[model samples]
Target: MDCEKQTTEYKSLLKIRTGDKGFKDLSVTCVALANAQGGRIFIGYDDKKKAPLPEQHVTPDEVNEAVTKLRSLCFNVGLVASEICTDDTGSQYFIVSVSPSMHSVATTSDGRIYIRVADKCEPVRSEDLQRLGEEKGAYQWELVRTKYLLDGVALDALRQLANDIRKSSRVRQHVKQMDDVELAENYHLVDEGYLTNLGVLWLGTAKQRSSICYPATVQYIVYDVLERKVRKEEWHDNRLNPKELLLDIEQKAVELTYSYEFPNGLFRKQIRHYHPKLVRELLVNALAHKSYTISSDIMIKVFSDRLEISNPGGLPLGITKDNILHAKHRRNPNMIELLSALEMMEGEGSGYDLIYELNAMEAKNPPMIESSYNEVTVIQNAEIIDTELLPLLDFVLQNYQLTQKAFTAFGIIAREKKVFSTRLSAILQLQEEDRLRSYTDKLLKDNIIGRNGAKKGTQFFVNPQLIKNAKVNLKTTLKTVEPYVLRTLIMEDLRAHPKSKISEIGGRLPEIDLQELRKMIYSMVDVELITEGARTDRRYALK
Candidate 1:
């Protein structure tokens, strides 16, 4: 059984068959799981011990009895599928599968609502209903019509938007033919003589936004190497709508951003320390998906070597850092539609995809995305790791059409020079080998990439001929250089950790294979650069 999460829960018993409690305890959990995201419940399992209790086999009737009374005990949830199964050691456990409630909320027979949060089932508080309902598709905060009429919105902003959309190449030509009124309605910005919450965001004035407590603010601060602030600019003027705010931020970022140039052929190739498209898309995503209910400004911090952008509302419900690239969950549908029409995204629900694609194009490290309960922060390192990759990726773009994910995979291989198959899936945040292959197989087949070894020891690298064609200046072979570089990194890591296991080293460098990493450590041991611990507690340390 998987560990308890937002979707899975484990229990020691199927039912509390004593007195008047009936199956209330198990039923409450079922309702809670169904209310949030459909999840599984495993009974007769000892979660702490990580084992199944054999005594559970003696109570087969209890499992069937609980399933019989499930519907009457849980409300607004579908009929749960359950089963009694035998484990390898002949231990029996009951399992109940609950689907997410079709309704916004799932309740118990007593009419109290509950929701699954992380690993625990908590009673739903009144304020949490909106958040849960929106996630469940029952409500959209962006569509709620405001008390203000269309006339109440800032007319100046509306005119600017009309002219902007009229000239926008991204929006459909026929759709752009509509006048301001029709365009506003089509974009879900207005209702019958009234402005929707989204309308208030884009067309309203500072006063209107203040009334709703809608925060349309951004803080751009520059920091020195020592983390001391050198410059700061803030925009809290709600009079500036989403578009104007985006443009303002983009303008300032462009002025302050650092760009590097590389010598190529007879000319020079210039790359921004941070790509403009990346900054624009990151801001757009932060604005589009940010929780408008929370009155907080998006903060952008420009460090000496990287950029950090954090927005309120970590991620939309059901979206996590591990699955952000693959999962699509829009917190603000109206805002999303407007941004998509504005051509900020590569396609619908592909902002993160575009970020990954852009990051790869520069052959930089994969941008870091993390979320807490209250905030989502994206960190983009500004340093360009590989300069020769610029013209080569252009070659691929001209010769082939790869998906955003494929481009990202190609960039990883291009930068790393050589990567083992065992490390690819974890680095890509993809759990399946075939899924990883989907993004990389075409590169191999087209001879854009080279593969060596097989299975666990299988290695992938960018085709050397491709580099030669791109006119890359090679001092040493690309494939031969990475191991020596990785050895230096390993020694640095062990020097800091002193006595560290292979897992500890791998945790710091997830791109390296454990077996290959072990061999590298042993190689260092042979050179008296490292010391190894005993067999039972095998660890590596600096000599």
Candidate 2:
């Protein structure tokens, strides 16, 4: 197969003959692949020729040897299955598939650890390996029994949970029919006659929760426009389960909220400072995805103008912010499954999509996401750009089926008043104009949005008919300034102070070194995204 990048998260390697030197210590590659995603090994096949060996005949010895060697060599890596397949000419190859390690890292016989990166297997050492192990660790911790047993579960809380599940329409009839222990066991809250880590967090007494297997915290901090902390609340008590925490946090946000009210048809519409649904969805996700191993709080920092909901861990193994809008990977599947049973999910791992959809409908700024090795934070700006378009948005939501990206693109044009196609593409983080068709084609086809001019001059806007129907009278507002600089910082600086030199930008972001900043400036300029002034005195601005 073509091997520039892995075709899937999996890969396949070839071994022509068992006696070949390549066969002696093959478990290194096997273990590495298991530690990462997982791959298959094809015996009696040649990696160089991409075909079965010409001279190699049917060999039961090779299959047995390969199996025995792999069993003896790799630990914590499962040889999931094996099969022998034949080509058109009846040439046989033995396939040995290694499954990804669930809760730990796999290592070679000699204690050497390696991880797959693309088509190659590379050694991972020290902190990188530690991070790898932690990536796989949530599965183990979620089901592990804490110091508590089923009897330790608070009776009131257990009764409360049973009632909640029974009340939830999302839960199945059979699931709702289960007794208390059966319900807890079915949800993985109770295991092997004991309260699991999740069970303790969900049903344990306040005192039991405050003293669980892990020292965890949940904080809701309020801030003014200046970013100074005004008020704070902590929820390590865990008296409330995940669902209860979601409601309490959402309610508090509503209590502190300011709102914009207007007429829509016969009824008055009210848009709060924070969307309560979005708040619950974001918080529910934070509760589900947070790394329990990381001894940090799931923090909701509410600013006068925005909200930053931060959880302890970065994204899971294969998730990044760019793909987070569509890619779904759950660090804690048990939490997700249980939450789904209670109808606490926004959609099937589509919370980000819902966040985007809700923001778009409200004409609010698209949620800004920040992720790093230690934390993942979602920043939702509270300002509404267009109040008049709410009626139009309501019409669209009621009428059309838009993908997450389509709604976001529509929102951008509607909020910005007018947006150039290329610039819109960039803001959407799309690298190819062709891919953008999927988001805008329907809008263009339905005449929901009109495209004018061509190429760089092309502008997209909401349909005149719809705007007229709603009597939107949209104001011609400047584009919302993104505070992104370089990869994520500096855009605000350039927008606020056009044609700024490195020194000027440096003054604003003192944390980044001047030389490194200079290099980055030139690199961005090389892509023709930024323009530079005189060589003797370089000043830069967005191109």
Candidate 3:
């Protein structure tokens, strides 16, 4: 039998001589493989390569009996088996491949649950199981019943929340006429006479907040990095009311700001270390999505140059850091709905988008998001030191029509003063330099940027006239600037890449049509400035 070492996708078991215990063990291993990414398991083969020993081969009948028993296990895990086959030495083995479960965790026949951790299978712990349940949306802490009774809910708190909701522009006018009980029902905070966990979190009395098993709180810390210790004022508050908790955090953050002034003639503009609106959006996310089942408090760390906020939960179900900008998954849907109705949360999933745009407009580094087993932390850098290009970026974001990539390329050149066209491609992390012209050429034709040097040493500099508000007319025909400029652009392409195809050259000048590109190439060949290789393997190069 062909064999390979055990890995995430492969495992081997020596169960040819099977018994009850061996079959149960094999069943548990199959459950784990199904929970994780699907993998193949070999039954009569040694985990490690071995010298041919007398094969303890099992008959097909025995393997078929084990497969029959596995079919009736706790969960219908996707499994397929290979027919028994003999090796060169007459040693027989069979393999079973388990596919990953789409939406459920697999379990053994006797009700034991396990998941693959590295190369081994381990039993799922209670906390991890709860997390998995949450991931599957099988359990919602907010929807769970709380011990607090309806009479125990604070009347004043409910009135205040009702008034707050009524004042929000997003809320319906009819909500203003509903009584406290009706209001709670409208928000899914109450079912029958029982106040759910969601109800207690929002409208519970002060006494009710103290009786919860795991109280929701925020821990605020301002660190002095040079001293390597928490600053003078550090505190923790257990505020069960999400609205009040958000307000308190915002007040605390106000103390952390420092301002600078930019003077222009008789007028002056004030800039804070970080934008308050952006900070509030981040706070709303941490408060609305934190796991209520965990005992941990939301953490806020303010440093000299950056601010970090973390909550006691990784990303919501189906959301990862790579897709955070476009993916919307809220762990506490109840809380998120309430917050959105109150106008506290902006459009769904727009927080990260706002953060990215704010950073780009300010010419600041983009925020960083990191996740671990039980937490997600976002670090926002506070410095806005790109004084020269800050105004330009602001204007571009506010007035210019540019795609995301094009805007990014514009920002890079405006900040760096001058860079090779390839450098912009590198900054964008694109593998091919040709894709960059789709962005840079727009700025070039508008005269917002001008080229310097020649060939491979070429550098692009942002035009000072553009910074001075000089209007650009980009509709002029290429015949006005085509002869010298187009030829130089092609020569620059050849100098950077000695042997490039015509299609690649066209990619670098996306503004020019394919027919126009062919005419230009032939015209350059006529002038002996460039040459095309044989038709069978067509490529262009500087003559």
The numbered model that scores best in lDDT is 1
Report every candidate's CA lDDT.
0.76, 0.72, 0.69
- Residues 497-528, candidate 1, lDDT per residue (tens digit)? 88888888889977566677777777787574
lDDT of 3 by residue, 1-543 (tens): 344422233323444345566767777878876765456777666556632335656677867776776666647477777898676778776778777664677888878888665567779898788766765578788887776667644566777888888888887778868887799888877778677888887878656665664557777777786736465333344444888878766776654566667764489877776787778888889888888777787888888888889998766644646557656777788888899988888757677766765666666766788865468899988887476566666666677777665666676676555666666555554556676687678777767677765544456766767766833222333322435787787888788986777788888776554554675677777464555567756777888
Candidate 3 total steric clashes: 0
Poorly placed runs, candidate 1 (over 4 Å): 1-103, 115-121, 213-215, 228-230, 254-256, 260-270, 385-405, 420-423, 426-432, 452-458, 467-512, 516-543
Candidate closer to the true structure by lDDT (higher is better), 2 or 3: 2
Kindly report which residue stretches of model 2 are placed more than 4 angstroms away from their true locations once superposed: 1-131, 137-139, 152-156, 254-256, 261-269, 394-406, 417-438, 452-459, 476-543
State the displacement of the C-alpha of residue 333, model 2, in Å, after optimal TM-score superposition: 0.6
lDDT, ranked from best to worst: 1, 2, 3
Candidate 2 has a TM-score of 0.63
Model 1 TM-score (2 dp): 0.75
Q: List the residue pairs that clash in candidate 3.
A: none
